[model samples]
Target: MEHTQDNGSVVYPDVKTDYHGHPNYFRVLIYLLVLLGLSLAVFEFNLPANVAIAIVFAVAVWKIGMVIRNFMHLRYEPILIWIAVFAAVFILLAFFWGVFPDVSMVHRELAPKL
Candidate 1:
């Protein structure tokens, strides 16, 4: 009896093509620059609190999208998958909004009593 490996290809094959190519140094440098700029904006800027928070969140979302599309290989996924991803994001935002008011009211009420 002989054991078979996954992919069912022979244990040793000659002249196999590499699935992954070499990294592009230029593209990686550009990504690094963008990340550094975003980091600087978050930590060094003297913007209003809400504005800073919004900027950070926006940059984070952009970075996440980049990673999902490139690193996760989701760029070619179906539209349904994109819709599901966006729907989950909206649901999370709604959940936070629903809880924020109650939390704010509780803090306000408790602050006055204390």
Candidate 2:
């Protein structure tokens, strides 16, 4: 048996649903805007190359996490779903690492002449 809320989300019997009353979309938008502004500022600032790149990358990761958690609603998902998502990322990183050396040698003397 299930009961439906006004928001249309069904409440199942014995199932744990930690509904946080739905996130505020406007607040998430504001957060995204701030993160975007910070990322853009990294390009405008005269910081050192390594520092600027690191900051921009960090901002990008932060933005991705925020989007995933809030926009994609991943924060409300079960632990298994999170594990699957992380596993996919791990596979992608493994693939990238496996191919990275060959890609880096593309313009070097070790590269085969075609």
Candidate 3:
């Protein structure tokens, strides 16, 4: 919504303030806490390293999705915005993969003896 003042300048309302409905922040916090507990439990249970790592990674992704959807209000955003965000993440992943070989090999390469 826009409003015109006496001077005839158009004023736009803040998007944050124009929310139609807000998520239950307390509920979201509880969900996040539960996810944290699950992540920690993977360590406490002394599972195999591979299993533990997978569980932790899955929990981390779930927590991130919850925060992004609720706290960031991304659930209300358009599909185009979601596509853009995913594209950015894909680019970051591509960059990491491109650099991983050099980074991983650096530690293995030994200096020539004098």
Greater TM-score among 1 and 2 belongs to: 2
Highest-lDDT candidate: 3
Which 10-residue window in model 2 sums to the lowest lDDT? 13-22
Backbone clashes in model 3: 0
Error of 1 at 38 (Å): 2.5
Which prediction has more favorable TM-score, 1 or 3?
A: 3
Over 23-85, each residue of candidate 3 has an lDDT whose tens digit, in order, gives: 678889999999998998888887899999999999999999999998897886789989999
- What is the lDDT ranking, best to worst? 3, 2, 1
Best by TM-score: 2
Error of 2 at 114 (Å): 7.1
The lDDT values for all models are 0.65, 0.82, 0.83
- Model 2 clashing residue pairs (backbone): none
Candidate 1 lDDT over 1-44, as tens digits, reads 12233345433323244222223445745885797588566857
Model 2 C-alpha lDDT per residue in residues 44-106, reported as the tens digit of each score:
889998999999899889989988997787987779999999999999999999999888868
Cand. 3 TM to true fold: 0.70
